[model samples]
Target: MGRTVDQEVHAAFVEFRAKEDDKVRCVVYFCLSVQCIYCQQIRAKNTSRQKQHLLECPGLRGHPNAPQPSQPAQAAPNGIGPPNGYPGTPNGPTATPSGPSGPGTIPAPNGTLMTNGVNPHATPLQAPLQALQNRAAMATPVQATGPPSAPPSAASRPTPKPKSKNSTSSLPAPPLDDVHAAFVEFRAKEEDKCLSVQCIYCQQVRAKNTSRQRQHLLECPTYLSVMKDSIPANNLLHTFPEGDVARSLQIPAPTLELDFRMSIKMNPKVNVGAGIWGQREWVSFIGGQWAGRWGKGIVLPGGQDTQLVTKDSATNLSASFMLQTVDDPPAFIVVRTDGWLTGAKDVLEKVIDSNMADGVNPGSYKYRVNLSMETGDERYTFLNTLMWIGSGCRRGHEVIFDSFRVN
Candidate 1:
């Protein structure tokens, strides 16, 4: 409805003005306005004070624009031109004031900022004050006894000088990109030898332990187990942040617990399995086993919450969590097994071809099912963020994941 005469819609605006977002924005706008006003006032005062002091200072005495006793105050002398008011002008400081002096300065007649009908910028300093002007024109307090005395300055002031092209301040020395480059070169020398591995480039450098290789047996099984696990692991998107580097420990092939790579290398056909709760659970995995387009990969059944319940149900398996960017190549895959399922590897291959170059769409690939399982101190705030792997050189790739019971 239209408002009646004298009735304004301002009330309607003011009434709804305090909504959460609106009130917050309003406060921000108000603070900004106040700050702008204060800044303008400060700038105005500084500019005005600078011009006034320049008008009466003597240290500026030798300056070409400095006022002289012999010269009658020149006409509206703007800063710099031909003579007195101007740099090389004829009727500059040498010229007599067409009018007598009493006022400090006249305003700039052509510009805005007129006060008392005077163009302040147009005003020239009166030469009569030359006697009173010191290197600094000290506006002093009058002592009842002595002649008008020069007063101490409220603050110390520095004399200004002409700048030259040769002045160090003229051109900032070029940014020290050279110094930065040198730093990079120096750091390169301190890098680990392994970082120079062939066929790969990294934005980071790692440091190697100079000490002779210690017994790697303990971690031997761990490494193979991890790689074996990840070979067919599924990934979760929007679960980890962008640019995050992940690390996981793979359990060795079950039979030869403690070490699988060594076992595999020793025996090309070493059966791998899981051992937990005094039971043995073997895993069957292979790639490119069947005819054309047939699935070829490992199998990992979606973990059951029951795995954490009784010792009998638990499988001595270790899995690491990693994030795969939506639409990116499959970084991992996990096959599900139901009591030695038939054609286990086929499922893995099916999930692979479906996901390869097409990971964004759902059900396109077989994934180790996650029922929105959140365990550790999940970074809930950044759940939807893109995730990437960290530099092994920068962050140690030994991240550990602990299982928590979910109700």
Candidate 2:
């Protein structure tokens, strides 16, 4: 028959009694020093000690039939001390022993009597045990220690992503409406095309854009004045004498259209120096042509231009001339112009000098004139009522001007 696990473990060590010994000892080691068959640790030849050693030995603990250890008395509440207070001191209160010891005796894990030991000096053990209790009361819990986890490696960390920029596109302009379209005009430039609008009510010109044009209407003085009158008001309102006379504080500015152009032939200037106002001169017209919306004509000769040359060399011109229209019997028209030819002293000297004036840029000086026409012929009755303004440039021996009619 096969031996049980307990019997096999018991047979591994042999028991013997030495000649002068009172206790039995294992022959597997020595009569006085017994060595554990499982763990090979040397122990004294005490039966109870050997038995407890067998229970705790790591080698014997592997046996299938090895005895299971008793659960340690559930730790004292909060684990401050052993169960039932201090195992009885010599004169201290005692507790019931769970082992085969005398009353008030306790067995400790190391096979020592925690109380009532045979040693009469056992009372000193109380101080260390009491110190242990005090240390446990103040002790901090231990955290588990091991190899510190390596800091997350660079490759293992997540990479931060960059934020994208928002790109917004401009919206297209609104379609032009009929009311506003009348104000906007398409104009061509040298490099590109653009739109322009003139507020008919205020005469202020601006680049034509739908939003800006709408804002202009909201703030135009003339438009606002006319709008206020067209709407009825319930409250009493103060009125200005000028505004009451015309329902508007500011009159709508007039518009001008191209009307005519004239080329006047000139004779040499006759200097009449040191007049009451300034140095004076006279320049007479020999012959020229005038073409206009009214009719094409030849300027009758012997017209005179009286000039007042100011201290700054600015010339003021007053001219009188006659025009003959082309017809079976030509009708006669009288022409008179008054204006200034003004610029920097050097520029005006260059402009007036016939020798150096031929190619001088006209933009270097200004030759502006206001003109009036008188005609007795019924065919051109409108000439007496209308007025004209013109800008002119000087050539070697002649002056050319383009005139616009004020409407």
Candidate 3:
């Protein structure tokens, strides 16, 4: 038939003992079993008492048979226990035993009428035991299962702190000693103002803030590439909007034109020197007068014109002079004239032979001059922004240049 109650109970104890270490052993004494480690003091021969002792024993901490706080000996919240408990223990109330012991009956921990490992007569004690078991289960930490969770998203993380204004200032100052030594660099005399720097690359003299100066050093293609590393990248450099540079650099077309008659008093040419290129002649400008739609102006004296007569059938001449207007508030204009005289015959020889001033001329020569003028006069500041194309024609003791603004 089926196994006896003693055999089943003993089998359960043997199974438990097999899973434990030698530190906590189950010992049999006649009809009872006890824990060897704790049996010396209590001297209990009951298997149920031995199980209770094993639960509380300090030596059984790491043993498999040791009780876990999560899985207590008492029934669960809905009156559920281990599979070895009596019938109806998982379903509802404890099942009543037909006799003192039956096939489906389990022994109680205390010395009382047992039914499915629970005491049928001990109704008052069940509440306290369940409370203890509930507390133990609640105190235990539940383990996670499945794949590990992903890290928090960038948006969820705490925002980074804003960098101080001086953080990027740590980079070494622009290397003024090396390649940029030719550039004019000076700090602003006033506090909190930008430095005045004359960039040799663009040949522009302008005052730029520290941040813009650093950005220029980084963005300028003419600057030495190796020197760019001296400045650290910062938000200020990138704050400028895209295409803003292109828009800022968009130049407008010229709109106005002027033709002026100029009288020139030139000095005798002096041979300066000769080089592999050609001969060089120094021509000094004594004085002149110019009158046009703009106004009447006097070409001040003390200007010099350098002529480079090359062997390649070409002549390049450059003249630097000043022009003073006869306006109510006199304004001074700095003029730089560069010209190219091409063909075999020299430009001065053509002027004399053709008798251009007397209205006797042949269209067999070509001489063109470009004029760059800079003036501080507010009324004529527009001359600084527009490009002018000028062509010179000799007329007697005077020269007439038709200046057309390239529209």
Write candidate 3's Cα lDDT for 66-98 as tens digits: 343333346658877545433343335553333
TM-scores for candidates 1 onward, in order: 0.17, 0.42, 0.34
Misplaced by over 4 Å in model 2 are: 1-247
Candidate 1 wrong stretches, greater than 4 Å: 1-82, 86-125, 128-407
Candidate 2 structure quality by residue, lDDT tens digits, 19-130: 2233333222122345455454654466666656666778655565444443334444677654332344555444222356643344443346534232332333232333
Please give the ranking of all candidate structures by TM-score, highest first, separated by commas.
Answer: 2, 3, 1
* Clash totals, every prediction: 44, 0, 2
lDDT of 1 at 362: 29
- TM match of model 2 to true structure: 0.42
Q: For every candidate structure, what is the RMSD over all alpha carbons to the true structure, in angstroms?
A: 27.0, 36.3, 27.3
Better of 2 and 3 by TM-score: 2
Q: lDDT for model 3, on a 0 to 1 scale?
A: 0.50
Better of 1 and 2 by lDDT: 2
- Candidate 2, which ten residues in sequence have the lowest lDDT sum? 165-174
Candidate 3, poorest ten consecutive residues by summed lDDT: 12-21
